[model samples]
Target: MTDYVSTTPGLYPLPDWAKDDLSDLKGHQKHDLISGDESEEITAAYEEAREEVIGVQQDADLDRIVEGQLRWDDMLAHPLAVHDAVETRGIVRYYDNNNFYREPVVQDDLGFSGDVANELEAAAELLEADDDLQAVLPGPYSLADLATDEQYGDEAEFLGAIADFLEGEVDAFPEHETLFLLEPSLVESAPEDGLDERASEAIDQVAGATDADVVVQPYWGALEEKVYAHLLDADIDAVGFDFVAEQDDNLYNIQEYGATDDVSLGLADGQNTLVEDPEAIRDRVEWVYDQLPVAEFETVYLTTNTETFYLPSGKFEAKLEILAEAAALAEVKAA
Candidate 1:
């Protein structure tokens, strides 16, 4: 059997350092020449912010580290890396102008214009630099939901292609204990009609493509039994449930699901300023542990639902401190 492994809940809450770095680039016009085709100031700021976020995570004794998503802006700009891989396009629509930095949506059918192998390689390098790090990527479901569907006619086809593309990318990662987290933020918005079926198929395609332990993580709302049931049947390594948003129901669902495959306990609030009480989180974890073997419980991870809800850099830092303290307390209790 694999050794027991534990990781912090994904997204430890943004630190103030992150927010400050973001603010510096907030008003800068995209594609504008701030410094010879790229804004050196923005680049430096992001690098600094990423380091700060990573530092905080390390200090917290987190078993896995995220590159602080400082490269989020850069990643968005390169959507074509993942987008073009699947054929279809039109202007990609933003879920909300508030969440994303870019305004233009793809106006035609999406197609891969360049090789993303380099991008994936760079990301892997960053993750590998940290001994305890895992790479997170946007799942195909969310990509389909976010893409402009004007030219694609059907989102299902686009999603399937994207899944194939993702599988290829996952296979490219260097061998390590690193886990790849597939965050499908749009799963919550899946239509009640036949959309759930399409989403499930797309998820399966991606799950089947990767060798690393995969976690199909959805946040912001409760996962309907119809949707989650499919994940339970998929070959995924684990399913991450956002308990912070829908605690009671999600917790119960996890208890039922935890009996089978691994489950991630999303107790940390990834989007809010409210500092979580470590004791309370531990109690909840304990409640779940009571229902499963200690080895099974090791599959559980503590994390936030998403990372888009941070206030600013300073506040983000404070939040990380809080999370670390709470997690430390929980570790003590667990030991």
Candidate 2:
């Protein structure tokens, strides 16, 4: 049976109480807090919000749960931006989305800051002993692409440095059974001049540093054939394609390029406000199964194409319900 996983790529919208708690600091601000000191109310809110998300996941009977990255200051770039060797610059648009992130400027040699590991640790503490928790981070190539490289003059060198830094970060993190490396930039700005080998090398190094099963998820849209084919050569366990954005293209890519060791079917639309029908989602999953050469891959993951952080809290919950229902229906039909 395919695993139904929740991928929290970035900041999940804070619940009302959590929003109210952080009102004193800055509510829905585009930038990170100048001071890292979080109030008691905000701290409690984070804990409460986590418990609620976990409860929802448990009720939905999801195979795996994500940390729901409620504290991401600048989306995927926050962790890298806050490093001692990096500095935050002017606000910049986050890809094609309405969301924005402070541009990360690499001031010197990159290093593991342990900020992400600490954040993951807090989330890990909240999980039950039996819970299969997944930790997420921005992929090295994507992070290198996002940041302004003032230190490393060469693009490949910069990517290597960032990958090594992430390798250390992954090593520091608590033993996560699964780790997701979000690689949106690879698809968003498909490097046409053949950076494939370098990207694959960087991804392999970072993925090899951890004992956990690593999945590299490229959201936003479908990757070009050359890029997608090269990505499969990476050392990660699975690759997640954005079916919500370009379902036909993604499905075709899988048919043409062939399957990876495993695949993540992103059936849920993350950015849409309208809730998808459970039956419709189930039908889509069935269609995907028909198209895919299932025996070629080890496993499949049913999940959102991107982060659920784009949706309102209510709609996000509804999407989860949809996923849970669809998953259950798929199982019954298979049986």
Candidate 3:
């Protein structure tokens, strides 16, 4: 088993109180709000938000800690959207959610300047248990799915370019125990006929760039059968299911195809504000074990179906506490 972890998908909602102060934090780096005067204040806001998010992980007794990605705009497009090689196009729906993100229009060859790696380093500086660190990024297939691809006109070429771009970023990621490649498009907008292999290969290309165990977590729903099979074929260390949104399909897929030795179960509802009872969460975990033949899995992570940023900060923090309490009740070693 790589490790036991209780982690959110990593795009956390900025607390209501901090929203105004930190809303422009990402803008500073994007040069959208490049007032050199706010440089000290920007650094102060990021540090305070990092401490708030990481402190909650500590309070929940989570084994893995994230930087909360407080400065990220969205998972898939932020890296590309902010790149000099890409343009921020009009806003588009994020998967099937009510939320939206600016579409990234690629116009040149992909490049990386250590954006995520820098965030991971900032997060590491605030952590005492160094190995407990984890990082998150949007996976390649989804990044391609969610963006406009004029640079690489061909489908496979576009996917490969995005993968190559992410691979470069992964190579620069600070040392961490786990890396989550969020690939909601795999479930939301299934790949076209016979393209599952291309998608899987593109994913593995980026996963290969990192030493950290990679968990390719697809959410909003479950992947189609072939997509799920191909995803399992990738060089991933684990996979996460949106048990809240597509429990039947996800459960059926696991029973049919089995699973990697490390699995993440998205038992909590990421889109809702109401917190679930820890006992109910534990019951869900035990129920899976009773229903499936997955006892061989080295670690079973308890996480949300999608990123928790959709919820209010207080509700998000409550969800974190629920995860830890439930993991403890289930006696899962990692939480």
Model 1 vs. true fold: TM: 0.75
Tens digits of lDDT, candidate 1, 66-123: 5554444423333432343233323333343344433324446444332334333443
Top candidate, metric TM-score: 2
Better of 1 and 3 by lDDT: 3
Cα lDDT, model 1, residue 312: 54
Better of 1 and 2 by lDDT: 2
Taken over the whole model, the C-alpha lDDT of each candidate is 0.55, 0.78, 0.82
How does each model score on TM-score? Answer: 0.75, 0.92, 0.92
**Clash totals for all candidate models:** 30, 0, 0
